[model samples]
Target: MLTRDEALTLVKRHVSEENNLKHMIAVGAVMKELAARLGEDPVKWEVVGILHDIDFERCTGLTDHTLIARELLKGVVDDEVVGAIMAHNWENTGVALDTRMKKALVASDAVSGLIVAAALVMPSKKLAEVKPESLIKKYKSKEFARGASRERMVISAEFGVPLEEFLTAALEGMKKVADELGL
Candidate 1:
């Protein structure tokens, strides 16, 4: 049950590049939002999300990222959380993520990237300055944020919510803490 702050400190020590750190913060913001909306344990889930990519800095290849992250967090977090992180890039790790946390992690991880991309396009380059309409527009265009996996962002709907609605909820969650994200 580590707070996002504690996780950030740990991640900063473990991984120092600015973009990677911001990615963690973005994931944390979205994860906390998703947790609050779902009435789940926000701190725990967000901590899991914030640290999901903890091993990426040391990873030499995309295929090894998930396994590296798992190995790094093995003794430091709950088994469920570790499994969720390992399961995030199942295509790379061959891990099946069936838990709610895992599913949400997949969604938050992907959508947060899209949201941040959208924010950067805004005049203010801030999350609070971005709108659902703008995101929806960008989401519709096949070319927007080409790296963002739409398939992953759609995973939240599998848990019974529509993708657009999921995006709205996730965006609002991040916006609530936009100041921390510098979004």
Candidate 2:
């Protein structure tokens, strides 16, 4: 497995957009926290989260998304990590979500978006001011963070984490990196 620094270096090399990079960091922080809570390897899960979208800036279509990531990450990370990245985009790629890590990756990816959207709407525009309840409220209205699929977030249950608990962990995770995220 790649060290966190190496994974981040790879992400920076492939992803230049500021917001896109921050989004990866946010998902990674959340995945680390989720892994800790679930008694999994936090470093591995976090690395997977950070690298999941390394190909996003270069991707041209749904097929190019995870497919490109799989190619770029070959030999740099384990097959499981690569598979988790691809599994996060399972709807388009047909990869089965067979592992808890994969399910958490998918859920964390969507929840992080919803959390950021909620924080942006707050008066302080800070993750510190954002609450899990606010995320819960926003989760119901599809208009809020429309790109953050509620269906995907609800998959947290598959990882043995309740939806509310998952959202709270995600919010806390983003809050942990609020300074880096400028949120």
TM-score winner among the candidates?
2
Model 1 lDDT tens row, 1-183: 566788888888778888787777778777777778778888998898779889888888778886877777777788888888888888888889787788889988888889888999888898888788888888878799988889898899776668888888778877876777777
TM-score against truth, every candidate: 0.93, 0.96
Superposing every Cα of model 1 onto the true structure, what RMSD results? 1.4
**Cα lDDT of all candidates, in order?**
0.82, 0.91
User: For residues 1-183, what per-residue lDDT tens digits would candidate 2 score against the true structure?
Assistant: 777788898899999999999999999999999999999999999999999999998899787799999999898898999999999889898999999999999999988889988989989999898877877888888799899989889999988999989999999988999998999
lDDT of 1: 0.82
How many collisions per candidate? 2, 0
Report the number of the highest-lDDT candidate.
2
Regions of candidate 1 where Cα sits further than 4 Å from its true position: none
Predicted structure 1, TM vs. truth: 0.93
